[model samples]
Target: MVDYATARMNMVESQLRTNKVTDQRVLEAFETIPRERFVPDHLRSLAYVDEDLRLKDDRYLVEPMVQARLMDVADIRAEDVVLVVGAGSGYACAILATIAATVVGLESDPELAKLAESALQEQGVDNAVVIQGEMNKGYPKQGPYDVILLNGAVAEVPKALTDQLSPKGGRLATVVRSDSGPGKGTVFERWEKAVGRRTLFDANTPVLPGFHKQPGFVF
Candidate 1:
Protein backbone atom coordinates (compact mmCIF):
# COMPACT_ATOMS: atom_id res chain seq x y z
CA MET A 1 0.00 0.00 0.00
CA VAL A 2 1.15 3.53 -0.77
CA ASP A 3 2.04 5.78 2.13
CA TYR A 4 -0.60 8.35 1.18
CA ALA A 5 0.17 10.66 4.12
CA THR A 6 3.79 10.91 3.10
CA ALA A 7 2.79 11.26 -0.55
CA ARG A 8 0.57 14.25 0.28
CA MET A 9 3.41 15.94 2.15
CA ASN A 10 5.79 15.35 -0.74
CA MET A 11 3.29 16.81 -3.18
CA VAL A 12 2.97 19.99 -1.09
CA GLU A 13 6.69 20.41 -0.47
CA SER A 14 7.79 19.57 -4.00
CA GLN A 15 4.97 20.18 -6.44
CA LEU A 16 3.38 23.18 -4.69
CA ARG A 17 6.05 24.96 -2.64
CA THR A 18 8.65 24.66 -5.36
CA ASN A 19 6.24 26.14 -7.87
CA LYS A 20 5.31 29.38 -5.96
CA VAL A 21 2.32 28.04 -4.09
CA THR A 22 3.09 29.96 -0.90
CA ASP A 23 -0.32 30.32 0.63
CA GLN A 24 -0.20 28.52 3.96
CA ARG A 25 -3.92 27.67 3.97
CA VAL A 26 -3.68 26.30 0.47
CA LEU A 27 -0.64 24.22 1.37
CA GLU A 28 -2.30 22.84 4.48
CA ALA A 29 -5.45 21.98 2.59
CA PHE A 30 -3.45 19.99 0.04
CA GLU A 31 -1.64 18.21 2.82
CA THR A 32 -4.72 17.38 4.93
CA ILE A 33 -7.24 16.47 2.26
CA PRO A 34 -7.10 12.76 1.51
CA ARG A 35 -6.56 12.93 -2.22
CA GLU A 36 -6.45 9.14 -2.37
CA ARG A 37 -10.11 8.98 -1.45
CA PHE A 38 -11.11 11.12 -4.38
CA VAL A 39 -9.69 8.84 -7.07
CA PRO A 40 -10.80 5.40 -8.19
CA ASP A 41 -9.78 2.38 -6.15
CA HIS A 42 -7.22 1.24 -8.70
CA LEU A 43 -5.70 4.73 -9.02
CA ARG A 44 -5.71 5.88 -5.40
CA SER A 45 -2.01 5.16 -5.02
CA LEU A 46 -1.27 7.70 -7.72
CA ALA A 47 -3.38 10.41 -6.14
CA TYR A 48 -0.58 12.71 -5.00
CA VAL A 49 1.40 12.55 -8.24
CA ASP A 50 2.15 15.84 -9.96
CA GLU A 51 -0.44 15.36 -12.70
CA ASP A 52 -4.15 15.61 -13.26
CA LEU A 53 -5.82 12.41 -12.11
CA ARG A 54 -8.38 11.12 -14.58
CA LEU A 55 -11.88 10.65 -13.28
CA LYS A 56 -14.90 9.10 -14.96
CA ASP A 57 -16.07 10.32 -18.40
CA ASP A 58 -12.90 12.13 -19.43
CA ARG A 59 -13.04 14.44 -16.45
CA TYR A 60 -10.01 15.26 -14.30
CA LEU A 61 -8.94 16.51 -10.90
CA VAL A 62 -6.79 19.48 -11.88
CA GLU A 63 -3.13 19.01 -10.97
CA PRO A 64 -2.08 20.22 -7.49
CA MET A 65 0.37 22.94 -8.54
CA VAL A 66 -2.10 24.57 -10.89
CA GLN A 67 -4.91 24.24 -8.40
CA ALA A 68 -2.91 25.69 -5.53
CA ARG A 69 -1.80 28.62 -7.66
CA LEU A 70 -5.35 29.37 -8.70
CA MET A 71 -6.54 29.26 -5.11
CA ASP A 72 -3.73 31.48 -3.94
CA VAL A 73 -4.42 34.07 -6.60
CA ALA A 74 -8.13 34.04 -5.90
CA ASP A 75 -7.38 35.03 -2.30
CA ILE A 76 -10.23 33.12 -0.82
CA ARG A 77 -11.31 34.40 2.60
CA ALA A 78 -13.04 32.63 5.42
CA GLU A 79 -16.32 34.45 4.62
CA ASP A 80 -16.20 33.87 0.87
CA VAL A 81 -18.58 31.62 -0.95
CA VAL A 82 -16.85 29.87 -3.85
CA LEU A 83 -18.15 28.09 -6.88
CA VAL A 84 -16.02 25.35 -8.44
CA VAL A 85 -16.84 24.63 -12.09
CA GLY A 86 -16.31 21.10 -13.41
CA ALA A 87 -15.54 19.87 -9.91
CA GLY A 88 -14.67 16.30 -10.86
CA SER A 89 -14.61 13.99 -7.82
CA GLY A 90 -14.78 17.15 -5.59
CA TYR A 91 -11.12 17.37 -4.70
CA ALA A 92 -10.99 21.09 -5.32
CA CYS A 93 -14.22 21.66 -3.44
CA ALA A 94 -12.91 19.79 -0.44
CA ILE A 95 -9.78 21.87 -0.46
CA LEU A 96 -11.71 25.10 -0.88
CA ALA A 97 -14.01 24.19 2.00
CA THR A 98 -11.16 24.43 4.45
CA ILE A 99 -10.36 27.99 3.43
CA ALA A 100 -13.65 29.46 2.31
CA ALA A 101 -16.93 29.83 4.12
CA THR A 102 -18.81 27.62 1.69
CA VAL A 103 -18.08 25.84 -1.59
CA VAL A 104 -20.47 24.86 -4.35
CA GLY A 105 -19.20 22.23 -6.74
CA LEU A 106 -20.87 22.20 -10.15
CA GLU A 107 -20.32 19.08 -12.22
CA SER A 108 -21.96 18.12 -15.50
CA ASP A 109 -21.42 14.38 -15.22
CA PRO A 110 -24.11 12.78 -13.06
CA GLU A 111 -21.99 9.87 -11.88
CA LEU A 112 -19.05 12.07 -11.16
CA ALA A 113 -21.26 14.47 -9.26
CA LYS A 114 -22.56 11.63 -7.12
CA LEU A 115 -19.07 10.36 -6.50
CA ALA A 116 -17.89 13.80 -5.48
CA GLU A 117 -20.74 14.24 -3.04
CA SER A 118 -20.09 10.87 -1.48
CA ALA A 119 -16.39 11.48 -1.14
CA LEU A 120 -16.89 14.91 0.34
CA GLN A 121 -19.41 13.65 2.84
CA GLU A 122 -17.21 10.74 3.80
CA GLN A 123 -14.41 13.17 4.51
CA GLY A 124 -16.73 15.23 6.76
CA VAL A 125 -16.47 18.22 4.47
CA ASP A 126 -19.64 19.90 5.62
CA ASN A 127 -18.96 23.31 4.12
CA ALA A 128 -19.30 22.08 0.55
CA VAL A 129 -21.99 20.63 -1.68
CA VAL A 130 -21.81 19.00 -5.10
CA ILE A 131 -24.51 19.80 -7.62
CA GLN A 132 -25.15 18.51 -11.14
CA GLY A 133 -25.44 21.15 -13.84
CA GLU A 134 -24.21 22.33 -17.23
CA MET A 135 -20.59 23.35 -16.94
CA ASN A 136 -20.92 26.36 -19.26
CA LYS A 137 -23.83 27.82 -17.36
CA GLY A 138 -22.81 29.00 -13.92
CA TYR A 139 -25.28 27.97 -11.28
CA PRO A 140 -27.38 31.14 -11.19
CA LYS A 141 -29.31 30.11 -8.11
CA GLN A 142 -26.13 30.72 -6.13
CA GLY A 143 -25.31 33.92 -7.89
CA PRO A 144 -22.86 36.57 -6.80
CA TYR A 145 -20.11 34.28 -5.60
CA ASP A 146 -16.99 35.67 -3.97
CA VAL A 147 -14.66 33.33 -5.88
CA ILE A 148 -15.27 31.11 -8.90
CA LEU A 149 -12.79 28.42 -9.95
CA LEU A 150 -12.86 26.58 -13.26
CA ASN A 151 -11.45 23.13 -12.61
CA GLY A 152 -9.97 22.83 -16.11
CA ALA A 153 -8.90 24.83 -19.10
CA VAL A 154 -11.41 26.52 -21.37
CA ALA A 155 -11.11 28.10 -24.79
CA GLU A 156 -12.83 31.20 -23.42
CA VAL A 157 -14.36 32.36 -20.14
CA PRO A 158 -18.07 32.47 -20.76
CA LYS A 159 -19.95 35.60 -19.70
CA ALA A 160 -22.53 33.49 -17.92
CA LEU A 161 -19.89 32.34 -15.48
CA THR A 162 -18.44 35.77 -15.03
CA ASP A 163 -21.87 37.21 -14.44
CA GLN A 164 -22.08 35.23 -11.23
CA LEU A 165 -19.09 36.95 -9.70
CA SER A 166 -20.06 39.39 -6.98
CA PRO A 167 -19.69 42.89 -8.35
CA LYS A 168 -17.62 43.73 -5.29
CA GLY A 169 -14.11 42.45 -5.83
CA GLY A 170 -15.27 38.95 -6.70
CA ARG A 171 -12.82 36.97 -8.82
CA LEU A 172 -12.87 33.97 -11.17
CA ALA A 173 -9.78 31.92 -11.99
CA THR A 174 -9.06 29.33 -14.67
CA VAL A 175 -6.64 28.09 -17.30
CA VAL A 176 -7.47 29.36 -20.78
CA ARG A 177 -6.24 27.12 -23.61
CA SER A 178 -6.75 28.15 -27.17
CA ASP A 179 -6.57 25.76 -30.07
CA SER A 180 -3.01 24.70 -31.03
CA GLY A 181 -1.26 26.62 -28.23
CA PRO A 182 -0.32 26.45 -24.58
CA GLY A 183 -2.79 27.27 -21.83
CA LYS A 184 -2.54 30.40 -19.67
CA GLY A 185 -3.63 30.77 -16.08
CA THR A 186 -6.16 33.62 -16.10
CA VAL A 187 -8.22 35.48 -13.55
CA PHE A 188 -11.27 37.69 -14.06
CA GLU A 189 -12.18 40.17 -11.37
CA ARG A 190 -15.41 42.11 -10.96
CA TRP A 191 -15.87 45.54 -9.41
CA GLU A 192 -19.26 47.20 -9.50
CA LYS A 193 -20.00 47.04 -13.22
CA ALA A 194 -16.49 46.43 -14.52
CA VAL A 195 -14.54 43.23 -14.94
CA GLY A 196 -10.76 43.03 -15.37
CA ARG A 197 -8.65 40.09 -16.55
CA ARG A 198 -5.01 39.17 -16.11
CA THR A 199 -2.85 36.17 -16.98
CA LEU A 200 -0.74 34.67 -14.21
CA PHE A 201 1.27 31.75 -15.62
CA ASP A 202 1.39 29.12 -18.32
CA ALA A 203 -0.14 25.66 -17.95
CA ASN A 204 -0.85 22.69 -20.21
CA THR A 205 -4.00 21.40 -18.62
CA PRO A 206 -6.69 19.22 -20.17
CA VAL A 207 -9.72 21.09 -21.47
CA LEU A 208 -12.94 20.29 -19.74
CA PRO A 209 -15.95 19.07 -21.69
CA GLY A 210 -18.34 21.80 -23.00
CA PHE A 211 -15.51 24.36 -23.12
CA HIS A 212 -14.09 23.64 -26.60
CA LYS A 213 -14.18 26.28 -29.28
CA GLN A 214 -17.14 26.09 -31.63
CA PRO A 215 -16.35 25.18 -35.22
CA GLY A 216 -17.05 27.83 -37.81
CA PHE A 217 -18.80 27.00 -41.06
CA VAL A 218 -16.38 25.70 -43.68
CA PHE A 219 -16.36 27.28 -47.08
Candidate 2:
Protein backbone atom coordinates (compact mmCIF):
# COMPACT_ATOMS: atom_id res chain seq x y z
CA MET A 1 0.00 0.00 0.00
CA VAL A 2 1.20 3.52 -0.76
CA ASP A 3 2.11 5.65 2.19
CA TYR A 4 -0.46 8.38 1.52
CA ALA A 5 0.25 10.13 4.79
CA THR A 6 3.88 10.58 3.86
CA ALA A 7 2.90 11.48 0.31
CA ARG A 8 0.54 14.16 1.60
CA MET A 9 3.30 15.65 3.69
CA ASN A 10 5.72 15.66 0.77
CA MET A 11 3.08 17.25 -1.40
CA VAL A 12 2.67 20.06 1.08
CA GLU A 13 6.36 20.57 1.73
CA SER A 14 7.56 20.19 -1.85
CA GLN A 15 4.73 20.77 -4.30
CA LEU A 16 2.74 23.34 -2.29
CA ARG A 17 5.17 25.15 -0.03
CA THR A 18 7.89 25.33 -2.65
CA ASN A 19 5.41 26.91 -5.03
CA LYS A 20 4.42 29.85 -2.77
CA VAL A 21 1.51 28.31 -0.87
CA THR A 22 2.47 29.81 2.50
CA ASP A 23 -0.88 29.84 4.25
CA GLN A 24 -0.66 27.61 7.34
CA ARG A 25 -4.33 26.61 7.25
CA VAL A 26 -4.11 25.65 3.60
CA LEU A 27 -1.01 23.60 4.25
CA GLU A 28 -2.56 21.86 7.20
CA ALA A 29 -5.72 21.04 5.27
CA PHE A 30 -3.71 19.41 2.51
CA GLU A 31 -1.81 17.42 5.08
CA THR A 32 -4.84 16.37 7.07
CA ILE A 33 -7.18 15.37 4.24
CA PRO A 34 -6.69 11.83 2.98
CA ARG A 35 -6.56 12.51 -0.76
CA GLU A 36 -6.42 8.76 -1.33
CA ARG A 37 -10.03 8.44 -0.27
CA PHE A 38 -11.24 10.84 -2.93
CA VAL A 39 -9.95 8.89 -5.91
CA PRO A 40 -11.06 5.57 -7.38
CA ASP A 41 -9.69 2.39 -5.84
CA HIS A 42 -7.30 1.88 -8.73
CA LEU A 43 -6.13 5.52 -8.71
CA ARG A 44 -5.83 5.77 -4.96
CA SER A 45 -2.19 4.84 -5.07
CA LEU A 46 -1.46 7.87 -7.18
CA ALA A 47 -3.73 10.30 -5.38
CA TYR A 48 -0.97 12.28 -3.75
CA VAL A 49 0.97 12.78 -6.95
CA ASP A 50 1.41 16.33 -8.23
CA GLU A 51 -0.87 16.02 -11.28
CA ASP A 52 -4.61 16.47 -11.55
CA LEU A 53 -6.47 13.22 -10.83
CA ARG A 54 -9.06 12.38 -13.48
CA LEU A 55 -12.51 11.31 -12.38
CA LYS A 56 -15.74 10.18 -14.07
CA ASP A 57 -16.84 12.13 -17.14
CA ASP A 58 -14.40 14.78 -18.39
CA ARG A 59 -14.08 16.35 -14.95
CA TYR A 60 -10.90 16.49 -12.89
CA LEU A 61 -9.76 17.20 -9.34
CA VAL A 62 -7.72 20.20 -10.40
CA GLU A 63 -3.95 19.69 -10.01
CA PRO A 64 -2.59 19.82 -6.48
CA MET A 65 -0.48 22.92 -7.10
CA VAL A 66 -3.34 24.82 -8.72
CA GLN A 67 -5.73 23.90 -5.94
CA ALA A 68 -3.25 24.97 -3.30
CA ARG A 69 -2.47 28.24 -5.03
CA LEU A 70 -6.14 29.10 -5.51
CA MET A 71 -6.77 28.63 -1.80
CA ASP A 72 -3.69 30.63 -0.93
CA VAL A 73 -4.91 33.49 -3.11
CA ALA A 74 -8.48 33.41 -1.84
CA ASP A 75 -7.25 33.76 1.77
CA ILE A 76 -10.31 32.03 3.20
CA ARG A 77 -11.38 33.11 6.70
CA ALA A 78 -12.76 31.06 9.56
CA GLU A 79 -16.26 32.48 9.20
CA ASP A 80 -16.45 32.44 5.42
CA VAL A 81 -19.20 30.51 3.67
CA VAL A 82 -17.59 29.20 0.51
CA LEU A 83 -18.96 27.87 -2.76
CA VAL A 84 -16.82 25.47 -4.79
CA VAL A 85 -17.70 25.23 -8.48
CA GLY A 86 -17.07 21.95 -10.36
CA ALA A 87 -16.03 20.26 -7.17
CA GLY A 88 -14.89 17.00 -8.80
CA SER A 89 -14.17 14.58 -5.96
CA GLY A 90 -14.76 17.08 -3.12
CA TYR A 91 -11.07 17.23 -2.32
CA ALA A 92 -10.94 21.00 -2.58
CA CYS A 93 -14.25 21.30 -0.78
CA ALA A 94 -12.94 19.18 2.08
CA ILE A 95 -9.83 21.32 2.25
CA LEU A 96 -11.90 24.50 2.18
CA ALA A 97 -14.09 23.16 4.97
CA THR A 98 -11.09 23.25 7.28
CA ILE A 99 -10.58 26.97 6.80
CA ALA A 100 -14.10 28.15 6.01
CA ALA A 101 -17.21 27.81 8.10
CA THR A 102 -19.19 26.09 5.36
CA VAL A 103 -18.68 24.92 1.79
CA VAL A 104 -21.19 24.08 -0.92
CA GLY A 105 -19.52 21.85 -3.48
CA LEU A 106 -21.28 22.03 -6.85
CA GLU A 107 -20.82 19.41 -9.54
CA SER A 108 -22.60 18.71 -12.81
CA ASP A 109 -21.83 14.97 -12.81
CA PRO A 110 -24.38 13.12 -10.78
CA GLU A 111 -22.20 10.08 -10.17
CA LEU A 112 -19.26 12.21 -9.19
CA ALA A 113 -21.38 14.29 -6.88
CA LYS A 114 -22.73 11.18 -5.21
CA LEU A 115 -19.27 9.78 -4.79
CA ALA A 116 -17.92 13.06 -3.51
CA GLU A 117 -20.75 13.38 -1.01
CA SER A 118 -20.20 9.85 0.21
CA ALA A 119 -16.47 10.30 0.53
CA LEU A 120 -16.85 13.53 2.51
CA GLN A 121 -19.38 11.99 4.83
CA GLU A 122 -17.29 8.87 5.22
CA GLN A 123 -14.35 11.00 6.23
CA GLY A 124 -16.51 12.95 8.68
CA VAL A 125 -16.32 16.25 6.85
CA ASP A 126 -19.47 17.88 8.13
CA ASN A 127 -18.92 21.43 6.95
CA ALA A 128 -19.26 20.63 3.23
CA VAL A 129 -22.30 19.60 1.21
CA VAL A 130 -21.77 18.30 -2.31
CA ILE A 131 -24.67 18.93 -4.65
CA GLN A 132 -25.43 18.25 -8.29
CA GLY A 133 -25.85 21.25 -10.59
CA GLU A 134 -24.66 22.98 -13.71
CA MET A 135 -21.13 24.24 -13.18
CA ASN A 136 -21.72 27.63 -14.82
CA LYS A 137 -24.77 28.54 -12.79
CA GLY A 138 -23.59 29.36 -9.31
CA TYR A 139 -25.65 27.76 -6.55
CA PRO A 140 -27.98 30.70 -6.07
CA LYS A 141 -30.09 29.05 -3.38
CA GLN A 142 -27.07 29.03 -1.05
CA GLY A 143 -25.69 32.27 -2.20
CA PRO A 144 -24.21 35.42 -1.50
CA TYR A 145 -21.23 33.36 -0.42
CA ASP A 146 -18.16 34.93 1.14
CA VAL A 147 -15.74 33.08 -1.14
CA ILE A 148 -16.25 31.25 -4.45
CA LEU A 149 -13.58 28.92 -5.78
CA LEU A 150 -13.80 27.26 -9.16
CA ASN A 151 -12.05 23.87 -9.23
CA GLY A 152 -10.96 24.32 -12.84
CA ALA A 153 -10.18 27.00 -15.38
CA VAL A 154 -12.67 28.95 -17.55
CA ALA A 155 -12.68 30.75 -20.85
CA GLU A 156 -14.26 33.66 -19.04
CA VAL A 157 -15.74 34.38 -15.63
CA PRO A 158 -19.49 34.37 -16.14
CA LYS A 159 -21.39 37.31 -14.74
CA ALA A 160 -24.01 34.90 -13.42
CA LEU A 161 -21.41 33.51 -11.02
CA THR A 162 -19.76 36.79 -10.11
CA ASP A 163 -23.16 38.24 -9.33
CA GLN A 164 -23.49 35.64 -6.58
CA LEU A 165 -20.58 36.95 -4.56
CA SER A 166 -21.50 38.35 -1.15
CA PRO A 167 -22.06 42.10 -1.10
CA LYS A 168 -19.37 42.38 1.57
CA GLY A 169 -15.75 41.21 1.22
CA GLY A 170 -16.67 38.43 -1.19
CA ARG A 171 -13.85 36.97 -3.25
CA LEU A 172 -13.75 34.60 -6.24
CA ALA A 173 -10.90 32.65 -7.87
CA THR A 174 -10.48 30.86 -11.23
CA VAL A 175 -8.18 30.71 -14.21
CA VAL A 176 -9.12 32.43 -17.48
CA ARG A 177 -8.02 31.29 -20.93
CA SER A 178 -6.60 33.01 -23.99
CA ASP A 179 -8.62 31.34 -26.75
CA SER A 180 -8.60 27.82 -25.28
CA GLY A 181 -4.89 28.01 -24.63
CA PRO A 182 -2.94 28.39 -21.38
CA GLY A 183 -4.57 30.15 -18.42
CA LYS A 184 -3.69 32.29 -15.44
CA GLY A 185 -5.36 31.82 -12.07
CA THR A 186 -7.13 35.02 -11.05
CA VAL A 187 -8.74 36.36 -7.89
CA PHE A 188 -11.74 38.70 -8.01
CA GLU A 189 -13.03 40.72 -5.10
CA ARG A 190 -16.35 42.51 -4.88
CA TRP A 191 -15.91 46.21 -4.16
CA GLU A 192 -19.35 47.70 -3.61
CA LYS A 193 -21.20 47.15 -6.91
CA ALA A 194 -18.12 46.52 -9.01
CA VAL A 195 -15.74 43.53 -8.97
CA GLY A 196 -11.97 43.98 -9.18
CA ARG A 197 -9.72 41.16 -10.40
CA ARG A 198 -6.01 40.39 -10.35
CA THR A 199 -3.95 37.48 -11.61
CA LEU A 200 -2.26 35.37 -8.96
CA PHE A 201 -0.26 32.89 -11.03
CA ASP A 202 -0.22 30.80 -14.17
CA ALA A 203 -1.75 27.33 -14.09
CA ASN A 204 -2.66 25.19 -17.08
CA THR A 205 -5.85 23.76 -15.64
CA PRO A 206 -8.75 22.12 -17.43
CA VAL A 207 -11.82 24.28 -17.95
CA LEU A 208 -14.92 23.31 -16.08
CA PRO A 209 -17.82 22.01 -18.21
CA GLY A 210 -20.70 24.38 -19.07
CA PHE A 211 -18.42 27.41 -18.83
CA HIS A 212 -17.37 27.13 -22.48
CA LYS A 213 -18.98 29.53 -24.95
CA GLN A 214 -21.31 28.15 -27.60
CA PRO A 215 -19.71 27.83 -30.99
CA GLY A 216 -20.47 30.56 -33.50
CA PHE A 217 -21.94 29.69 -36.92
CA VAL A 218 -19.21 28.71 -39.33
CA PHE A 219 -18.99 30.47 -42.65
In candidate 1, where is summed lDDT lowest over 10 consecutive residues? 52-61
* Candidate 1, backbone clash total: 0
lDDT for model 1, please: 0.93
lDDT of 2: 0.89
Residues 45-76, candidate 1: write the lDDT tens digits.
88988888888667887889999999999999
Index of the highest-TM-score prediction: 1
Stretches of candidate 1 off by over 4 Å are none
For the record, the alpha-carbon RMSD of candidate 2 to the native fold, in angstroms, is 1.3
Local distance difference test scores for all models: 0.93, 0.89
Score every model by TM-score.
0.98, 0.96
**Candidate 2: segments with Cα more than 4 A from true spot:** 217-219
In order, how many clashes per candidate?
A: 0, 0
